[model samples]
Target: MSAWLFDLGNSRLKAAPLGEDGLPGDVLAFAHDGMALAAGWDSVLPPRIDAAHVASVAAPALRVALLDALAARAGRISLASTQPAWAGLRIAYAEPAKLGVDRFLTLLAARRRGGASLLVGVGTALTIDLVDAGGRHHGGRIAPSPTMMREALHARAAQLPAVGGGYRVFAADTGDALASGCLGAALALVGQSREAAVDACGGPVALLLHGGGAEALLPHLADAVHAPALVLEGLACWARPDGARR
Candidate 1:
């Protein structure tokens, strides 16, 4: 059976449908309003859908609203929580439930990637999750995207212009300088999180990176494998009882 995976974040809603083989068949990213059949939301969808799951970092009311919207279009819907699933991997957040669905789903997907992993979800907001070999999911860090970093700086201060574009390791000019500075900041945050995970677990942590921002964010992180379908893989894992590898 096919399954739908939704990573609902602040800026946009990322949805993908996975085929029986546990790989993404179709992908769609739309503005939050588009997905909502309600008043003001941009909605995007495939011609048809089967079962669907949502990992939402939205508020309770908003979550219920979005669930209601998806339920109208899809057959079955499951809302994932930070409360432990698949045995170990207890979410170690102060308010575990408040953890972003994308972050939690990334960790769930990381289960198959293997233990002692550094899970990174790069989108409008970037998140890093650390799962030890024993399946203990000690939480990681969160930061704005490279663009958002510049945007925040511009918003807070005055002179800095809102910057956008990919990162460069060796910036030669002004554009590259801005991109590299923002990129370096994001990489530093991700690297520090991975280093901390390695120190705590006393083993090398495998890196699994995904999300809309992956194209721009992956270059800066060292030795990170890009798995764009990680959320879909995790959704397939949740849908099927018999183990299937993606």
Candidate 2:
């Protein structure tokens, strides 16, 4: 059956076809405002699909817009939500519903790799989740991403440019300094999280990086696996008929 997977993040919408092997096909991404779909979005999806599985962490209005658009093309639609335990991966959140589905799905994908992992999603926010070899979540941390930090700073102090600057160890210019500080903070958090994960898991954990901003940090991470389509990969698993049970 022909199916599609959608991962609606805070600032972007990523969709891919689900192959027969239950993995995502080539992905298509579009950035959207919090309130509305981007122009020409309707023209991009396939003419029809048997199923549409969505994991959305975007604004409610954008989610509704996406669903409404998909309704015309999808025969069936499944929305992914956080669960306390699914497919052997147990959540650390006391209230599973409070956990973002993106993070949950990321953990699900990480667990499937069959080892301890530290998953970092660098998007509008920086999210770090750790799962052991046994598919047990040890919890996670969230913070503003480097891009968000820059935007926030620019908003408060107009002199700081929100977009242009290269990261440096010790920048002489204000823009580079801003970039260094923000990116450094995120890198430091990831480093600390990795150290904590190693202690908790009693060994080194595989570092899996994803999300729009992951590329920025990939060069700095030596052993990180960059899986930009991880959430979609998890959505493919979630869409499987016998995949995960509550």
Candidate 3:
């Protein structure tokens, strides 16, 4: 039976085909503005699959909307959630459910790579989670992502444009400065988190970067592994009994 995976995030809905190997096929993304769907949301979606597995960090209403859309296409649907431990990986959260499912899934994928890993997801928020060589969650941090930082700045000051410019070492223009500052801040956070992970885990840490905004941070992160479909990749792990050991 064929299965498709859906990752409904705060700003994007990504879907991919789940192969027998438990790896996701080409991923397709759709922009979701909180409650509203952006243009062409339906045009990009794949036709009905045999079953669907959904991992959502969106609001309850958004999940409802997504489920409704999938109901017509999927014979069965399963939702992913945060658990204390799964497939050798243990969550550090005192209240596991409070932790985002996206983060939980990311850890699963990170663990699949084996050994210590630092997952950096840049979406509506910049999230960093550390997993030791033994698959023990060492906690994480969430800050405004680059895009959010720009939006926040623009919101506070009407003069600043939320969307404009590129990253530069020393920005000559306002837009470049905003871009440089936000991305630089993300890069610095990653560096600091890497150091902390080394100190906490007392060993080397693999840098795993993912999410829609990950590209902007890529050029700056030299030792980073880019897995844009990481959340869905983790969803594949959650779908299987053995967690698809590669």
Question: Global lDDT of each model?
Answer: 0.71, 0.91, 0.89
Higher-scoring candidate on TM-score, 1 or 3: 3
lDDT of 3 by residue, 1-246 (tens): 889899998888898889888789998888888996566565655676678999998899989988988887788999999989988899999999999999999999888879999999998899999999898999999999999999999999989999899989899999999999988999999999999999999878999999888988888887889989889989999988553432
Over the full model, what C-alpha lDDT does candidate 3 score relative to the true structure? 0.89
- Residues 1-246 of candidate 2 have per-residue lDDT tens digits of 789999998888998989987789999998887778789976977799889999998888889999999999999999999889888899999999999999999888887778999999999899999999998999999999999999999999998899877889999999889989999999999999999999999998999999999999999888999999999987776887773554
Clashing pairs in 1: 33-41, 33-42, 34-41, 34-42, 34-43, 35-42, 35-43, 89-135
Better of 2 and 3 by TM-score: 2
Return model 1's CA RMSD, one decimal: 4.1
Best by lDDT: 2
Pairs in clash, predicted candidate 2: none
Question: Sorted by lDDT, highest first, which candidate order results?
Answer: 2, 3, 1
Error of 2 at 28 (Å): 0.5
| Model 1: worst 10 consecutive residues (lDDT sum) | 33-42
Best candidate according to TM-score: 2
